[model samples]
Target chain A: MLKFDEQKVKENMEGALKLRPQINEVVDQIHERGFSNICWLGIGGTYASAMQAVVHMKEKTALETFYENAAVFLTTGNKRVTKDTLVVISSVTGSTEEVVDAVKKCNEIGATVFGFIDKAEAELATLVDHLISYPLNEQLKFFMVADRFMYLAGEFDEYDEFYNEMDQHFAQGIVEVEKAADKFGQEFALKHHQDEIHYFVGAGNQWGATYSYAMCYWEEQHWIKTKSIESHEFFHGMFEIVERDTPVTIYVTEDSQRALSERVVNFIPQICGNYTVIDAKDYDMPGISTKFRGALSPFIIHAVNNRIDVHIEKINCHPMEIRRYYRQLDY
Target chain B: MLKFDEQKVKENMEGALKLRPQINEVVDQIHERGFSNICWLGIGGTYASAMQAVVHMKEKTALETFYENAAVFLTTGNKRVTKDTLVVISSVTGSTEEVVDAVKKCNEIGATVFGFIDKAEAELATLVDHLISYPLNEQLKFFMVADRFMYLAGEFDEYDEFYNEMDQHFAQGIVEVEKAADKFGQEFALKHHQDEIHYFVGAGNQWGATYSYAMCYWEEQHWIKTKSIESHEFFHGMFEIVERDTPVTIYVTEDSQRALSERVVNFIPQICGNYTVIDAKDYDMPGISTKFRGALSPFIIHAVNNRIDVHIEKINCHPMEIRRYYRQLDY
Candidate 1:
């Protein structure tokens, strides 16, 4: 719990939930105006965090969704993004060079750009056709964007109703997250923070959170060696790295592909010396129904990971905010 | 060129080129039949190799293309797939369980599935609606598929004509590959094969090759630590991990984003001790036009990396073919 702020976490979650009405209003406008397809663009963690929602939208909705790295899109133009396409993009600073350039390119192509940003007056906001300013918590911002798309799809009413209940019990949910961290996250971090390399494995929506945590939290923030491998592709090539003493972190979601994660969970412990399993089912979302708990695994896993991040910072004696090159050096 | 096989590589290149007519015929059939969109399904190296083609299709074609991991696609269904959808898949051995399962799922969903395989009597070929059996070189198979999609898009006739010319000089091209490897690849592998971790940075289509070599070749084959990061995102987060002696292999292509790759090339060597910059412009493809050289960078780079693979194997005393778990153990 070192450096953890219970009040700040609660406020951040609450602030994001408080924007539900605005987000719904924006969704209404997008629906009214109409769009041929949806384009989600970002770089690094921004790109990684958007995967969960993209996967969900792809499964339950017929809407064609293009989730691309902002820079990659600039190199390989998306043929699907016509004037009728609606693009959802996010950058906390509103000044990520690749994303800003991507927004400019989108404008040139006459696509309708919708942005979610922390800075209302920043360059990205200026370039976007519509901007929804929000506080910077990647999980919350991605959730808001995904919620709007899911609402538009009209295929997840049950899950949406469950999300509303989570919103109602928002503070209680924060309390539960903190309690779960004490029992799970901090202990796991304390045990394995010094491992030479860590593998983060998960399936379904939680895979996105797993990827984001490996890149943004472990590698970017802590400079720790990490690799995020999806459970489905784990056997393909990456699983070769697994040795008897290899460190592995497994995220088990309640999503449709829970069995896939379960497969790895069963297999890894038998061979890999270290297995840190964070199962979303272990965390109690007081007012959230079991049916929808799986859908919210990405957020739940992210909150647990935040606690682990605090513990890792304390153990490594390195501030998570310190950076050797990111934003400090020009490339 | 420690383990280079000059005549074999020439034959391999010629064999792949010889299939161009067959590939064109298959593409003509697909064009005549018509499809609502394109879905590409593969896993591991197969999935990684398809990126260049997908990007090219996205850039020049109005046709919407979906590139997905075969296993991930099974768990999270692609809503865009229907009877009208043309799904293209590849597996060399025809026994990749996930791909076979994916083909079965596509059949159940009534989507038209076409496969590129090594054998017509193989499982994947049998499951697919149509099959183009070919050699195992990723560059050739992907080119066949992409050429078909680009031909359908009706914007890449010039590039296609250039490809035909290169195909005619296929044997001569292998010599170019060896010359480039002697000048570039072996020196790189010899210098930095002892490094703990390596970063592969590139932009445009080469990004896909970087990723494939990182995971499928280095990590999977050699069990070496590797991270393939896009040049644009390098500044965002992954750049923080770089140190004074960090080993970085940079790929500079002649594609539209050459400036982007140049940015990374100019910056990395100043901070990192080791800089293996493989610029495609250095390789000479005799019959290929200067304007079209950039488009051929992915193949040129792949061939160069193959030489580097030989040196890495020699240094580590680990044959690239040996695997501890991949296809050796059940997941």
Candidate 2:
């Protein structure tokens, strides 16, 4: 409510929903054509978002999926990306150099390229074999592209049903997340505004959200120190850094890996001095089925985390959009 | 060598060399028997080490390879892991619970498992189908496991020749790395000893070393904050965090992707106030071929970084081995 636009959030969600027909048509055509494997490519937030699709594919489907950073993909070409490979890439700004280069390489390799470009007239839109032009909202665009590929992989027979459920439930979820963010996010930011280091943990699909929120929203936006590790990997080595006052944020998805995060949720309070658990299970998705909630948690969590982004900026008096070096100076 | 034992380094290098006959026999069997894919499983450092093998596979061979966190693997159960899948795991203590669980699961799936166990009497030694017992040195163990996978994937026609070369050149490389680390590493620690945050950048095979050093050594061992990002991904979002005095360490591997890391080497110094470049090329890896240097750089870099670890501990007056929570208190 402070810096977040509720109307913009709803419009972004609806825009993704509106692409359901096109997503279905494109997926059907790809399925009919037949592909060997699926490849997801992007950079930064987009790459983190594609990682969620990879986790979803691992959990729900038997499809061979490869998720890679767009820049790295160019240097270390995936051997699996042959003529039969399907490459799905999303670039909020169609001019991301690495994504454009990757798409060009995919074309050279004769792989089927599906591009999700925010701008209709962007470079990636022209480079890709199939372009899905939409308004750029990194979070929503991720869902649109990932959902399309997931459906094409034949994991969900009720793809249309799920899309309808999203249409009915996403607006309500946003309002609920906004409320939670204003209450909890504001309180947490006020309490820990001076804290320089934070740790974020998540498992399954929500792991990507956990990582993106820390890197894109927290570290890049605010220039804070953050480490985003998977929930299961938390106990491995990172758990050593748990001082009493160290802030920890756990994004628990309501998936098969729920127990994994729950383990940390129960343990952190006892060992960590400060901890915040954003359990997607706590969110009430009005019309969404329990079965689908786990799969849809990433999108819901994105909306929820969006509020924290607003609150941290509000409390710190920092412009969330300002960067010290990124695009400000060419490297 | 403040903390490093030169004798131990040579012994560890030789121990890895000693495993070659067994590694070769097992890999030859797997190659002749024919497996569908390769699965590299470990937790934390071991998982990070496994990642280098995955990168090597991507760069050199067309093998369908999967590198996963052992804990996450137990929960997610890769659809790729079948009777035809070859699961490679390394457990130094041979008692990592999640890794043992994963090995059991892989066994249940009838997948061929190769275990690199530090202790001959460890639990994983009993669980795996094939076991290579040696003293636990993360660097050498990584080389041993990764080389086996690389050979099994049919990347090398002269696997024995490579191993013999390693046997001949590894000791000299270790000694050379020790000298560089003492000189370069000590200077770095003295200058940036108070720095709390560090950014590690690497490309190609050295990317795994960059990550392992940041997470496993710095964060886990020293309880410091670190962001280990691939060189290509640095420009994506993480670069925004670069301030005038931000500490950035670049690991420049002498591989085809050397240019990738070089781009960051040239860029970071201009924007970031302080930076350290640990180019593997700077170390004289005598008798090792230039074409092979990139693939072997992880090992060379590991030895070189070990000196930095020693100096960081000495300067900070902190025992790197002490853990606040890891294995100290049970969760």
Candidate 3:
């Protein structure tokens, strides 16, 4: 039985909101550090958030900041700290081997390490020079607060009131997430009535949303035929595979990809050749809480991903089970 | 209506082979230009090859290089040219807008421009201070020649009889491609069984191979449900959606990702619910044209993709004519 405390989701969302300014303060320090490249390292859900953050950094600075293992600290270790490379490591447990390995690797080689974790005094914290902890909730999967906060630290400038604003957003966000679950939950459970396949797509900041969809579809429900690509690249080649009457969902965003969001919705029938779009933009998300910008949109979108897992699992007529385990990259 | 010159593939292949060393010899020369950052500008296939090249350069020297486009050049045109940043611009149709735009961007910024083209007196030639041209048979798409030379560039050390060896590679490569077309062409054409969706995945060097497969699944066969993702990221949350029997083709390498490759081939069956693999290690793709390292592995695999496309279209019976007159990005 999964124990998802509604209060916990509310609290974490609020925490992400409450801690937004603290994250910004950290970002101020990083910008001052003047590193040319920033690599965010993490595992599992945290790893996913790290990847999304790395992409956000690359787009903002045109610098080659990517997700890597802490082990890279051992190899590409910088002899002297310059404004060239900075590494941000995150781990929910803070004890995942790769994360631990990366932490030690950062230690062996004199590379700068900034960490995010729920457990401030965790083993990883002991290894890193600077560490920050996210507001922890009872639910194990509540690090979205920390992720959004850390990402804000690396990006925006006027987050003076971000913490207060984010808390408000998360309090309201829980209601929106429940509404999404209540609205789509049953329809998602009707696999027997529908065709034999399913697809989920997230556009722009909604990549995090689609990621949650995959978690639901493949992890809890055990559906294997789902995928999400950055919406801009979709038109280049993947459009031909959409079939007549196939179930497809697209996440909307107010980011640079808003136009792409609109395009997919309009062109679905024309381009997919036959599939229909199940819209989700009407489901309001808690974007304001973390002072989450429209551009960094995927963060707030992650909440609904949990319900989607149930939707897929209940429909599959199978026990809630993880049919496939994925490769978690390590340092 | 399509004019594919038969020999153009061969000529370009040889020309690509010739251009490799020139690119290698001059890469060091441009590195001496005193720029701290490197930016490569290219379009279409040239851009695709550049993606592969930059990864190789980064792996080999640990130097930081960037990829820029003309449209966003002014915004991303920030790297200092003081021996730390290097600019490499490439195009098959040397007149492509992006290439010309990059030339202007590089020149205005006082960055050294290294231009590679097929035509000697091409428009790109006029824009660049340092230009290199290979007499590739322009009658073909940059597909064949780009594959040939890019592969060679990744493989051989210039001083090691690279050209003669690759000359033989092209000859053997042609045979390998034709043979693949023969085996998979019929299966590619078997589109009547439309119950399944296809997801193509490639990692590291073979990343570009799936691009060719995209054309095969979408353009050639008109299968609109096909999608491609890099194999490394394929594991994480993405692996969860491997439907009860979704078709997944893994493109992997023997050297770098050997461990991951073996693990995925084993993992897919359980998680994907249904699966298949085209293993690079088990499959023989001509002789190891020592000069055609990992990136160009796509060219040989493309023969398989090309065969699939031509074969799928052979089923001319389905009259939906799924091809839309105009392509749009999203729904």
Which predicted model would earn the best DockQ? 1
Global Cα lDDT for candidate 2: 0.79
Of candidates 3 and 2, the better by lDDT:
2
User: Model 2 TM-score?
Assistant: 0.95
**Candidate 1: which pairs clash?**
none
Interface RMSD for each of the candidates: 1.7, 1.7, 6.0
The models' CA-based lDDT, in order, is 0.78, 0.79, 0.52
Global fold similarity of model 3 (TM-score): 0.72
**Residue-wise C-alpha lDDT for candidate 2, range B1-331, written one tens digit per residue:** 6877778777767776777778778877887898898888888888887888788777767888879888778787688889999888888789888889999999899999988888889767988998887776655655565567676666766666776778898776877778767878888788866777787889888887787788788878888778788787777667776778888889998766788899898887777668888888878878877667777777778777877888989989999878878777666
Docking class of 2: medium
Candidate 2 structure quality by residue, lDDT tens digits, A77-178: 788889998888887778888888888999999999887887888767888888788775555555555666667666667777887787888766766767
Instruction: Judging by DockQ, tell me the better candidate of 1 and 2.
Output: 1
| Candidate 2 residue runs with Cα over 4 Å from true position | A137-154, A158-160, B137-154, B157-161
Error of 2 at B324 (Å): 2.1
**lDDT (tens digit, per residue) of candidate 3 on B37-153:** 566565434444555554444333444554443433433233333334556666656766546876776777667776766676777788776677765422122322233333344
DockQ of each: 0.66, 0.65, 0.25
In candidate 1 the C-alpha lDDT for residue B270 amounts to 64
Worst 10 residues of 3 chain B by lDDT: B137-146
